[model samples]
Target: MVIYIILFGYLGLSLLLSRLNIRSKIEDSAQYYLTNRSLKGITLFFTLVATNFSAFFFIGFAGESYRVGYIYYTMMAFGTSFAAISFYLIGSPAWRLSKDKGYITPAEMLGDQMNSTALTRLTALLMIIFMVPFVAIQIIGAGLIVSGLTQGAIPYIWGSALLMVFILVYIWRSGMYSVARLDVTNGILLMTLIILAFVFVSRSLGGISEINEQLMEQSAALFSPQGSNSTYSPSLWLSYMVLWLTCLPMFPQIFLRFLMAKKESNFRYTSFLYTIVPPLLFIFPVALGVMGHLSFPDLQGKAADQIIPRLLTMHLPGGFGAVILTGALAAFVSTTDSTLLALSSLIARDLYKPIFKPQLDEKGTLTVGRISILILCLISLVIAFFQPASIFQIAAMTFSGLSIFFPVFLAVLRFNYRKPISAILAMILGEVVLILFATIFSGACDTLNILPVVPGVLATILILWLGHFFEKNKD
Candidate 1:
């Protein structure tokens, strides 16, 4: 009863907050999608952090840490901090271009810059394809957290769909406006709970020193740079570093943040916060996952994703655990809402408006976008049902999937590359290479010790460069 009350209460607060923020009548794409470009300073900072760190951050990071050990921290925390600087590098120019051109979606910006309608459509399609898996990762995380906490009372599908549908209600009402506003509240709650859980979990386990001593006696290889199983090889380490840095900012939701910024300084402030704050907060979950080895050493694979919930429910006090559980729910809600909005906006603007219904007015686009949200929710829920892999593995796969397109974005945005074929080929072939390696060439990837995304991203860059070279010669 306590858990149900807290869950419904949190969802109710989110719905109320969205109602308060949403315009009674959304009249234009500008108002509905980008929030009139008003996001700056603290609101923008919170939304960016909230969207970037999801159930994936809390559950996946902890689960990966439990599986491999401390190396997950260096890969995720420090590496992601380094990636945050791209906000200024990539965002500033995109903001300037969008400001001048009234660009709303990423495909719109790329298409205008490349002068290719084909590129615009393909970009939208590819991003949607790659992003659905990411959205599913959020659902998967939510399912694991909820079903684990309830011990099968709710079941994973119901647990996943419950939050997925609840999130859609707010986002469909006000679009990014509501999503961004909700992000502020969830971001604060998530950080506070993470810090509290870290401090409380360490204390409950008898302190950081005691936890460290136990690990030293039980499995000290966990402290090594290579981790317990040497899972993070030098090549693999390099792969993840590239994956987080290159692929992270290119996430359509994060990319949308660049479009939503009010000024260059907003990017700077948010970037700095991302660099410093997330890495620190991550210490909480990663450390919790590490210490979990002492008590829950038998937990393995996808079961490990339950470490945070397990620790809180069984080992910690009930009230504090409920508070922390709310934080987990907040993480799922915040991220899935943003992801759905981004995917819907891209489909509405880039795909539906241009290709299928060139006559789409703001009202019509709004309807299509709302409909897309429902469809995506259903699709993500279906994917969540399969439980194909661990949350960490699925998250990594999606990260790499998106990373394959990062170079194309850089080529168009940063390098003034004008060949649409190059961008299109990069998108198609990068994904093709990624698929081949992950599927038929799976064993080869293992033998190579480098992940498929490395070659995939490299393929994208190579094609873009060659296109630039040939075009330069032709000109």
Candidate 2:
């Protein structure tokens, strides 16, 4: 009952805050989709952090840390900071282009820059394809946390359903305004809880020194760069570093958040926060995983994702545990809401209106956006219900899937590759290679053992270079 009260109370407060912030009726699709392009410094900072961290960082990162040891941290934690560099490189220019031309979706910016309707449609389609899996992973993480906390009284599917319903409600109501406003609250709560979890978990399992001593004695291999179980090779580490850096800034949801800033200067604030805060925030999860291994050494497979929730529920007092559990819920909601909103914006503004109804008015577009949110949420919920894999595995696959776009985005922004065929062919060939490698030849081939993104990205660049040469020869 206390858990329910705290969980519902947090939900109620978030909805109330969203309602209070939405003073004016949404006049157009812009207001609903991008909050009328009016996000300021702190709100932008929090939303970016909230969206980027997600359940992947809280649940997936901890799980991976538990499975592989400190090597996961070396790859992901440090690699994540490189996102600040990506923001400086790609985000700034994209924001300028969006502000100048009233671009709402990534497809719009790329389509206009490339002068190709095909590229626009393909960009939107690829985003939806890769993003749904990520959304599914967030929903799965939420379900696991709730089920673990309730000791399976809630069940995973029910928890996922409940979460999807809540996300659909607030997002369908006010769109990006609600998402951004709620993100601020979620960001603060989650950061506080993570810090507390680190301290509390550390204390619960003796001090940091004692935990270190235990790890050294029990799993000395964890201290090595390759991890206790030799889970990561040198090539795998480099691949993960590239994946983490490119994936965060290139993923459509996060890339679009860069456009949400009220001004270019807002990114400066976001950049500083991204660089300084994430390293501090990641410390807790790495520590949690290391200590969790000591506490629950027998846990294996999907069960690893529940380490944080299990620790909070079993070790902490009732009130504190409930609050921390709410924080976990906040992480899921923050990422899922942002992803649904972004995907809906792409579907409604980019795909539906352009192809089906070129004359879609603002009200019609907003309605379509709302409906798309429901449809996408249901799709993701169904996927989460099946419980495909661990959060880390699903997230990594999604990142690799989306990394196919990185080379194209870079070409559009920096390389000035203006040929639409180059972008289109690159996307087609890149996706085909990724699908083939991931499905047909993943286990059979030793070369792909590093990571899928490495080959996926290489395939994309190869196609782009070939297309560029052919186009140049024709000219």
Candidate 3:
């Protein structure tokens, strides 16, 4: 009962805070869709942290670590570090141009830089499609967090619905401002909870070295990047790294933060800080999972996914469990809010405005954005109720499409390609081919071995070349 109260009370307070922020800045603009270009250094730093630390970091990363062992941490941390480095390399250049031209979306950025509307819309549409699954996953994750903390008293549907309501209320009010503000607050709480949980769990499990010894004994390949079980092999691990590097940096949610930065310098600053913060923030969840391996060696039933929650419920005493639950909820909500906001902005500004209602003023755009957010949240809630896939699977599927998008844009960025039609055709072909590949060879991914992203990127290049060839002949 007390846990339920804490959950509901936290939701109410977060909603109230969101509304206050929204009303306070009711005059905020379409320009503010990526943030108003007025953010200070600290605010931008938190936004980057908040954007990257999605529900996946908690549930997926730790779960992967728990199942695979410490070596997986190196892979995750390596992927994350590579992403940060890419931001510095490619993203800094993009940010400078965005400042010069006042760009709001990556679609706009790509379109403007490459001079291709078709390419812009294609990227925007792909972003929206991929992000739907991503946002839905986060919503589902929030529901899971609520359900777990409440001991299954609350069904996943109602828990998800409650989160959806809180998110809609908050986002409908402040737009990106509310998101940025809340992200900072949520990041701090997340850090605190991580430290607290580590302390509590470590004490419960004896200590880090003892935990390490048990981890090695229970799974011989605990420190082996070769993978503990046969499920992940050397080639497969390399493919996983390739897939993550290709897809994650281009994630619309992450890119949206780069777009929101105050300036090019801000992008660099925030990106640097985001690099350090995530690995540290990530270690706690990893610790929880590793500790789980040590303490409850024979535990089953979603053990990896439930590491933090199980630890809290069994190891941490008193009110701290509720507090940790709130932090996990904050993690879910932060990811969901940013994702839903980015998706809605894409729909309203990039999809609807350019196509149907090009005459909308800032106020009109704001109205459309808020309405789109409401509609998107409602649709996602319906999907969550069905529970079609696990949260991790949903995230993986979302990125599978986006992995194709990244390479196409990289090609454009490298070549300075002016043909929008070619770019669009390439993106579509890449996505379709990748989907076909995944569907056809789904069984072979394990035995024969091929990372999904490689084929999509190759297909993108082939299509672009074909499109260019045809266009030249037509000319």
Candidate 4:
């Protein structure tokens, strides 16, 4: 009941803000989608952090840490560093191009820059395809948290639906501007929750020093990979790093953030902040996992994702528990809104506007974007109803699947790999190879720590090179 109250309180606040901030019907359509391009440095910074962190960071990251050990931190390091690199390399250029061309979506930027209608359509199609899985993962996370706290009374579908309703109400009102402001508030709540959880939980477990001692005593591998209890081998480490380095940055939500900035300088400053903040955020979850090991080592399966919730419910006092749980719910809600908005924009601007109706005005685009948001949210709610796998597992699978496209996009921007044929070949070869390798030698390869996409990446490269060579010769 306390948890429910805390969550709805936040939802109520978000809805209220959305109602106040929404673009008036009399206002132009540009004000609705882009929030009049008036985001300042701080709001942009929080939006960047909130979107990038997501429910994946809270639930998925902690879950991964529990199952995989400290090697998960390496994944965070790879993602943050490489994403920053991509931001600087790809983001700066995309910002400049979008501003100059008045492009709103990534598909528009790619389509206009390359002058290929087919390429634009393909990018939008691929984005929609990938975004379903991505949005589904977040819905699963939100559902898991709500269902776990409510103890099976709330059903996953209802859990997802409730959150989505609030999200829809808020987004329908204010669009991106309302989402950004709420995210800033969510960020503050997240930090407060983390600091409090760490301090209180560590005290309960006997102090930081004692907790460290307990972890080492329980699983020396948690401290040192060279130790006998360590699960990660060299092969697994390499695969993990490669998968994250090549793949993590291309998240469409992250790319949409590059579009949200009021100025190019915001992108540059935010990238620098990313490198610093992600590592600090990793500390809270890493510490929680270590303590969880010492306290509840035998918990397994889906129980892993529930460790923190179980900890709070079983141990903490009333009001404090509600506050911290509210923070967790906030994390989930903020990430979901950002993702829904991104997916909606892709469908609205890219899929609907230029291809289907060349004459889509601002009002038409806004209607289409809102409608897209509703359709996508419904799809995710349906997927969340099944609730087969852990949210983290689904997220990891989706991340690997999307890894196929990062190289192609990076090549197009940084290198001269602009041939549409090369781009298509890379995506196809990479996906096929990934599917084949994961299928045939599935258990052995997975045990050996080989990423599903490694084999496909090699094929993608070869095909891309051959296509580029042929195109150059034809010229």
Candidate 5:
């Protein structure tokens, strides 16, 4: 426990370095939210990747890999690489637009483009509603990490509460500047430790042949695509690819990242890296989870979610799990900070000022944004504490819900694609379809092991296409 505390304290100190002598002017929203758009090169690269990834990258991936098999790798890699391509396709153009129009938030850009305050508020509300679960997943990972590190001396709720408070204070200190700086360090730390954890565990298992021999003897189901429990159906695999390609780019944290590029080349350089790097990093956790079955094959229920941590602590030397978990803690904190910051910006700029408090000045808006951070932290923590779902389940639901906004972004970037009403109808019907499939007719939704996002994304595009066609007919 002391070792875990010391390593985590070191991680905390590294994050604290972001606040050292970093003086940010919070009197203006753009300056606070975007770091004055000065991000580029390594800073931009780390910031975007770290902000885009969360505990979901490690905790969720490993857990799913443990549940299914390495086939989990295919969906995330292909899907996310396509999602990365959007950095050039959707992001570069949007960056230029934001630069020209002085737009800061996604809803602000969409609302102004379509001339609809209602759409602005609706988009903002939905993003927040869907994103909170994603945020809760971070807290859940942190809570699990903390409990594991302390050997259950600290309960999950208290662990989650600690992470929430830290994120709030960190954001209040210097906004995006601190968050970006923390991400630079955390990003490197997480990448290194994940790879290290993989090496250490694999070595302990006596390399590939032994692992394969053990797997074939004890858990042959791992080599199959249907997974140990037989959940990874073909439709579900394709659904994951589509979901990441469409949904990841629309995440408020990721969308906001588009507006922060210091140069056009930032998109080019980062796009290539984004396509390749995330997928490579994903392989380790998934492999670790698969290998984990060799040690603990009978992990029933949610115990599988703890596969990576259990593997690290039980297999490796003392204090090693502490170090790796510190990386885990950093991954969670890095994600929650960016997520909370982006959501606060959306609520403050898009909803609060325009809808309720039109007279708010820049400073007042900043204050509102900070306060919203606190409220959102509380809300996310509450959800984290009571969450009955696994990280993958929560992630799947949130990703699908947020993906409904893709058509709106599609119409926004392709000027010829917008008939404002068409975009609005597309977004609304997309969400409605998503809810129906996920709930009302869920049995029907699951018949072929299909996911709601598949239909949701298709329905969204179908509406947009129909709107475009009718407009041409009327013309």
Candidate 6:
């Protein structure tokens, strides 16, 4: 009963905070999508953190660590830390360009830089394709947590639907302003719960040394760099590292956040905080997985993803369990709402208004964006209800697909490759390679054992070079 009250209270508080922003008149799509480019300091920092640390971190990362071992941590820590450098390299310049030209979405920036309507639509299409599955992953994670915590009192499908509805309501109300405000609350709760869960679980298990000793005895491979089970090879690990490092900055959700900064100086502070915080935040979840392995070594399949929630239910008292569960829910809502808002902005700004109703004013555009949010949420809910795959696998495929845009973004930011043909062909070639490697021929050719991002990235570069060659020859 107390847990239920806490959960309801948390939801009520979030909705009230989001509603407070709805009273602020939105003068244009800029205010709706970018929050009028007014985010700064702590608000900017926490939103970025909250947006990045999704269910993928809490559920997927922890589960993978449990399944494979410590190698997952090493790869994630390095990949996430390296991603911070993007704030300087990619984010700062993007911020300056957006501030100068009033860019709203990443596609808008690319379209302006390359002067191609087709390229803008294509960019938005790819983001929707990749981001929807990413959103579905969060929904799945939330469902698992709710079901697990309640001991199946709420079924997975209902849990997922409930969470999605909650997210859709607030996000549909105020757009990015609501997302940033909620993100600040979620970020603080996430950090606090993670530390508390780690300390309490560690104590219950007789400390870290005992946990390590048990793991070594149960499976010495857990301590090995590649994991106790050889789940990730040297090649696979390298590919994962590269995939995360490049893809994190390019993700539409994160990309839009870069443009939301109030000033260039915000990026400097964001960079410093981003570098130090994620690695620390990741430590406890990875440790929780290690602890879960000791406690429940025989669990298999999707069961591993439930390790954290299960541990909380068994060890913590009712009130503490509710707090941690709410924190995990915060992580889910933070990511889901941001992705939904980004998707809506993409559809409304890039595709719907441009292609269908060019004369739509700011009010009409905001209406389209809100309606798109509802539609996208329903689509994602359907996907989540089916529960196609584990959170990590779904997220990995999504990241690989999104990574295809890295080179195109590079061309926009660093290089002078401004041809529409080049950008379009590069994206197409990258997507083809990603589909072939990540889907069509993934498991059949196990002897090669390369991650999809490895070839997807290379294919993008090759196509860009080929495009450049053709352009030069034409001249």
Tens digits of lDDT, candidate 1, 205-323: 89999898889899888898998879989888888788878887778888888878888788777788778986678888899899988779899678888788888876786656877
Per-residue lDDT tens digits for candidate 3, residues 190-231, read 778778888888877788878778777777665675555644
Q: How many Å off is the CA of 84 in candidate 6?
A: 1.5
The C-alpha RMSD in Å for every predicted model, in order, reads 2.2, 2.3, 2.8, 2.8, 2.5, 2.3
Error of 3 at 251 (Å): 2.2
TM-score for candidate 3, residues paired by index: 0.91
Whole-model lDDT, candidate 5? 0.80
Q: Give the clashing residue pairs of candidate 3, or none.
A: none
lDDT score, residue 265, model 4? 82
Q: Per-prediction TM-score, please?
A: 0.94, 0.94, 0.91, 0.91, 0.93, 0.94
lDDT of each: 0.82, 0.81, 0.73, 0.72, 0.80, 0.83
Model 4: how far is 361 from its true place, Å? Answer: 2.0
lDDT of 4 by residue, 1-475 (tens): 7767766777787677556655556243345555655665778888778776777666656666777677677667555655677787777777776667676677767766666777677877877776786788777778777777677788877888898888898777567778888878888777678677777877887898988887777777767752234556677667766676566556677776776678888778878887787777777876776677867887777677766666666568865766787777778878888778877877888878877898988777888889989998988887777655654354556666667766766676677566776666677678777777777767767776677767666677777778866765212
lDDT of each residue in 206-300, candidate 6, tens digit only: 99998898878988877888786677788777887778777888888898889998888886888788988867778788889878976787889
lDDT of 2 by residue, 1-475 (tens): 7777777788788888878848468878668878887998888989988887787677777887888887877777678887678787778888888889988888888888988888899989988877887888778778877776666788988888888888877877788898999999999988998889888988988898999898889988767789876778887778877777667777777887888888999877878878877677887887788788777887888788778877776679977887887777888898888888889889998899999999989899889988998898888887887766654464556887777887888888877778788778888888788777777778733464477667778899998888866775211
| lDDT, model 3, position 138 | 82
TM-score head-to-head 3 vs 6, winner: 6
Better of 1 and 5 by TM-score: 1
lDDT of 1: 0.82
